[model samples]
Target: MSGDAPISTPWRPSKKDARYTGPRACVKCHAEESATQHLTAMGRALEPVATSEILRAHPRLTFRSGPYAHEIVRRGDQSLYTVTDGVNTISEPILYTFGQGKAGQTYIFRHDGSFYESRLSFYKDIQGLDVTIGYPREIPPSLEVAAGRRISMDEARNCFSCHGTGAAYGNQLQLDRLVPGVTCEACHGPGAEHVAAMEAKQFKDKRIFNPGKMSADDLSQEFCGSCHRSAEQVISNKLLRGLITVRFQPYRMFTSRAHDPADMRLTCTACHNPHENPSADEAFYDPKCFACHRSFASLKSPAVAKTEEKEGRTDKACPVAQSLCVSCHMPKVEFPGSHFKFTDHRIRIAKAGEQFPN
Candidate 1:
């Protein structure tokens, strides 16, 4: 499960060879999975400004920091992002809304033929706007800077490649041919070949990449980590030393002492159903913990003993408690200034007043 051979997938959006057939093509066979997955956060990750429910619900949202003022207002079918310094002002029609607004939504717009990420983002907890995460906190020198942070060509390509399907092609972002949100083709690779194979009953070689076939370690560190930030990505990017890194689940989980690379049960997909939103019910995860932590004697079954013997390892049940194990060990930590709390993936006894592990 740890050092298995790499499983290749043709899901790279940057390459023109990947032909995406959209999620609609998948509904003919996988009706249920297609239906539920489309309702997940990843399904609605990116949407056009005109169809944003958050903006439609709240016609106007505003925030002020230092001498700058930011506002996002809905007029007709368009949402306008405006920023001002009293003397000078800049405004633009938001082109896209990133995120489904479960936690928050950020806007992206074009000004002077350049892409810019909105300076202010809508936080659901606050029910208004605030400075977008990772932006400078100080006052901007000009109205253009106050309006939004201009993104580079590479940044734009990267953002769209992850948020939307078929948005990237050969080192560039092809926004004109973009498909909003992470559709079925996004993870499963191009479905045109798979669909045709299935239609013709050619089961031998379906020609679709199944990420489920990947090993536990490869799935966590390579497949999902390609977007979610693997340990290698965090370390290389010099982001290994902050509360902000808590948002990167793969990196935090990789750093955990409890992380056994050979255990498939410890992988992300083992606990989280990637096709749906993560379950908030703590009880849902107890079985995942019990798969390893239950005492062999307590099991009173031969099957349990056989499994533990085969795995070459056994873990004792928690001496302290049995239920809601994550409440203490995997506590949720609030990201500074983001107005959101993310569950820390580092599985350990979280002692109060203790410094965050390096």
Candidate 2:
């Protein structure tokens, strides 16, 4: 869909055309993939919820920081937030939710032609509200504005660009016509030409951008890094490097010793399919790791692969356990306020009570 009209014209990617042909256009050709992708975090990353639904799920959503109290209440069709310190108060209607809400959901409101994230966010782990991810737990007493964090225009566009498909048209946010969540066009690029060619029964493939076909390093930087911070992005934003940003898989993966730009198996797609929810079973990832780590020079005893040899010495398996490579290597660490633990993607031997590798 383009604006208010159903796109029926033959697609032409000109300066005046609607380049993005929404996920609905891909349903007929990619029904199974489309159906499954909707369940992934990328698929439902952003959603516009009715105030009634928000109130029904979290009847008394609230959080307290210092002398102030932040509460979200539904009044009729609109959802409004009231922040108070027992003296002054500010109320604003929330317009959008920033996450799929599996881990957490931060509310956003529009005012003065821009968006602002709420002070408090709802985390599923606690099933209550807490300070939003990067914000400080306690607000300064001198600052009176309690409506929440106001996002800059660039920040607003960047947030929506990653969270929702077709939310931008060349850096200009089309917030009113956002497609809510990540969709086919988000990864595959605009589907207008692809759909047009397919519908016309053309035998040749009308090229649509596919990250899967790109080189491992290019894929990491362009596709995955479009949202997840890449090595270059992390390096550039040196001040932002810390435990909190380690959840960024691309940055961590590209920084790892295992990352080989020339090796196709080293990419994120080797272990993850964006269309499906990643399996939590750590053992399932062993095969992927072993593909490069395991020694296969044991024809006499094919069932038992030999240990890897290094510096004229053969290493032995851990006496305590065998499988689940991720158990010790990609240890789970919790972000300060997100209330959920994500596996450290740096892929290293982490020791107890020591600072983790960046």
Candidate 3:
């Protein structure tokens, strides 16, 4: 498989991806910020790979994704990332280093079919050692493309607007129209309107459709619920598999104890870096009950640790439930991505229906 050196033309919508917009449009307004994004993990996932210099540096690189189904290949310096065809519903390959493996390089291949931007491969071992992949909150591959809800007017269909940067939705049956992922306009909307206003000095239109505004409440809060909440599939389509609509579902994060319409109000940007992933590696989000929270002297989920012990070490300052504010409040529970492991987003007392110690 080969990836292109650089896409020369702008993404054109296939009938299947008529509702989508590409990322390039957003960069027109956010050019400066996206530069640093190319370095972070979130940006790295979507980083374009098309050079022989990076391709030939490693002995072996990943060409597929996932642990069981992942594949690896060695590249020659003469080779560059290029697509086999320009118009087919197929993808090219690029090397990515998820982490190191005992034997050598462990990686995943980046791919696109045209209508949407998503990763493939089952992600097995990096180098030769087993590695962690996919954040606790990310959707899986089998269901990512599975057909359930129709793409024309479903929330699931609309989700790709932000999930993908420059992707477009073409004809209902045409997956090839969903091209590219994670472009700037996905969040900021097409600069065609914004840029035009800016050039005309229409300062009032600065936030024509910003998420953080639009109501007395922070409109951005709705952004997190777009993916965090769990809702039923309108149909059985896998491509529409992510949480797109924000209607309340019991299992969804919004209904949990951590979220109270009266007490707690959090937007997507409140606890997360929107330009990034689910923020799993943020030092507190291991599927485990303890990580950074093991130090909270107070019972706040994200509370820092402070010790008042007779004789103990500083580590004790962050006691297990005592240190973990989330543990104390947002009890850990299991979900699809983590069956054996539990999640802590609800952020309330660990013992359900029990009185909180704090």
Candidate 4:
């Protein structure tokens, strides 16, 4: 999403033979989400760095000017630009926050030792020009110059089989890390088929499964709409790259009517604690209305049992107490790389003209 590939096969990672098999080596029963949620970006994007953490502070910096092998991607303080040099090279398109242009994003080059697919800068500035934000299917300005056609690990196993983590798709493919952008076996399953069904204790999944054992209210909201709901496009017309990965179902709260809760055991990790930080900590907000609405005389709705008996508070509330219960139902929403405080998991009602939904 940064480099400009159109010079004839400079981007790489195809013809399979890939491999990343690192981190959990078959997850080992999620082992506390492989260190607080598959190691971090809240779930997956590019972790394998650390040559002394990229030589600390560019310690003498120089992957030989540039062509590839000198890294650095960080967003909110400006850092883009990586390289392993051609057959897939990245670096450029910096703007962690400046009107959030650069249509979502797409930077993952690295090639042979693993990383694939790059180039997706579909443009965005709208009222200021350079439009074309990948509508129905515009990309054909000749595949928008990604080192002239090089994104192919089948265009990156459809966005790395769910933002990658311990993926091993054969004929040569191996990943164990990609940065923390998605994890817990990416929607839970491939820890080498549940670590060989838990060491023959004849394992019935020692943990993390059972969407109430899927009793079907449309298979528990399609097990979180397979990634928060935005399907159909099947192939072509670009658009797709691990949007906060799993349980974002239908993607980014897919028209979230508070994520369709009539309480079919309402899930999305139920008020989301997907390993942490969607502003959690109401002892993990409303476990299905605090397990049947936490006995404010069993709340059959006397105005939500008098607002939980006038916020008497639970387990001792105070999560920045707006009478806790998740500070008046999922609040905050500062946006723009978050240093300004970001919130908004869609659990709504802080309205004012479609106000702050970014």
Candidate 5:
């Protein structure tokens, strides 16, 4: 990691006493970015349960696993999560919804002053409820356990830190002051000082962290990876094995042969624009792939090859098709029980009926 790289720990206080000014303050100069970013998945990562569009739209969702029946229903402005096993029943008002529902949305509710992650989540692929990822498959021993899993204070802090901004301070979570979803300050550091400096027409000492200043490796491994799950984090957590690792893009990407620490072309921003929603159009990524993998016809030209070699762009041409490279190379693998297929970021020539690579 670069010494200049901003600390990877989310919600950690800035070196100075700069406070969070919220995303509205960022709209003054970055109107377009702020507007578009709010529409992205990262922008709506965490939402208050009462105002969740997915829950409001569905109204009611139910799932059956073993002897327990889980259900979530919208009541007036609030949503209620209930679990029952014939006789015993547990119900609570959902406090938070922890996803944008592109694939799924999990509910988090407070039970007896403690936070609990609902056992079942709404999966878009199934258009209904199912067990949340990583939850046990076996039947629960009691109604309380069937209702949801209790989470540690540190885990709750980390969850809110990533899903929302301005939620954690020091060792505590200030839920009352939490900002739902990732805003500009979440990645760029708190904007209060920057906003003040800009309003005062002082360009010098605009106190804010710019992730763009970090090197390619630092940006990939530490900056974006901090939330996306870096290779080091996955390995350290013993999550390097199985198809579940596919959801961790940075870790899978780091394992790819195309992952060159020195090459900016292989970095996350090379293909994705964080301010915008990710597009599924394969054509959109062909240019990024071609930046390194030249066309076979282009490689045959001696002059072009010589210039490329001189410019330190000597990556070999692809023997296969040119466009839609990601369709074949980065195949989507469906994780068991999640009901969603994640695009494996480990770019490679995928073979039919082959086992998933670690």
Candidate 6:
């Protein structure tokens, strides 16, 4: 038998009252929010390999990336992933499925009690397995443990902690105990005390951490930036430029002129609802921007519209395109290898045929 490994610091707060009660507890009171959140990408961020329909959708999933060949074989009740480096082969049962299969779905497999990410991912837009985002295309011949990135135990824990809820319990990475995706406790902290208070009809402070109540700087840096990389994190990691870095919305938004230090509503939650699935409609965000840029008083005026072609009625908004403000300011720029189009969060007036902003 093997000895126990050393325990690291706990991921969540050490407060005695902060215990997770799962998402079901929140459904009783916040039914609408909970129901809608369950449909979001964050809600289905992670799941067990067995629960993933993507794997079963394609019986024999295979892809070749550079010098390695990867395949996921379904064997009755189990799914086995095999990775080969031409001469060497390593096969393991797929343990977990990362992502919601919206952008992509990455697999995780265990070997020698350590977890490693599969090189190939099923991109929804592309509808095929390809090299995982930010991973090298060609793995070296010397590395034969897996046909993918061999992440450390700490890395594995961190990845799960972000993808799912209750991943870390008292300095231990308990994947089995994980709730499998971002649940109620992920953003609002643990809900055990809150549930108890609700049950007791106390109507007092439930000891739940609400990001909306935090200060502007704290809300942006510690709250939203907890998952979305903070300004400091992006700069520290040296991910300043390139299309790959566009995914770091907080860092980009922090650098934008729209982010006012004096205002609390200028944060990410201003445009995005934490409980709802993010919509792709560019016009949906125009009202959020117009709240700060243009006056609501203009919208109330029952004046002659442009569609009616009324003479002497000039619109104060953008002369060219008015409604879809995001399509012009926050243009969707395609990354080199990704099929998904990432809207630049650095809110700026983009010139036509201009290079991507640095």
Which residue pairs overlap in candidate 5's backbone? none
Please, what are the lDDT tens digits per residue for candidate 5 over residues 92-170?
A: 9999999865557888999988999887888877778877778787887788988888887878878887788877766
lDDT of 4 at 239: 35
Total backbone collisions for each predicted model: 0, 0, 63, 48, 0, 0
Candidate 1 lDDT tens digits, 73-129: 889999988888888778889999888654568888999999998877788888888
**Each prediction's TM-score against the native?**
0.91, 0.86, 0.46, 0.27, 0.93, 0.86
> Candidate 6, which segments miss by more than 4 Å at Cα?
1-11, 14-18, 85-87, 142-146, 295-319
| TM-score of model number 6 | 0.86
- Misplaced by over 4 Å in model 1 are 1-9, 295-313
Write model 6 residue lDDT over 1-358, tens digit each, in one string: 0011213212255343347888998998988888788768888888776767777777788887566677888887678988777787888998888886555688888876677887678888867788776665555544453366677767777787778887776556777668888877877767788788878988877667677777776777666777777777777765456666688788888888767665665677777888887778877887776555533344555543432224322325454565878878888888765667877889888899987766
Write candidate 2's Cα lDDT for 250-338 as tens digits: 88888776778877776888889888889989888977776666433332343454334332223333333457888998889887777
Query: Against the unseen true structure, what C-alpha lDDT does each candidate score?
Result: 0.79, 0.69, 0.35, 0.38, 0.81, 0.71
Alpha-carbon runs more than 4 Å astray in model 4: 1-103, 111-120, 123-162, 167-184, 187-190, 193-268, 272-358
Flag regions of model 5 displaced more than 4 Å: 1-18, 307-312
> Per-residue lDDT for 22-99 in model 4, tens only?
445745645665656643443544333232122233322222322334434454434454444446544543211111
Best by TM-score: 5
On lDDT, the candidate that comes out on top is 5
At residue 322, give the lDDT of candidate 5: 60
Determine the C-alpha RMSD for candidate 1 after optimal superposition of all C-alphas.
4.2
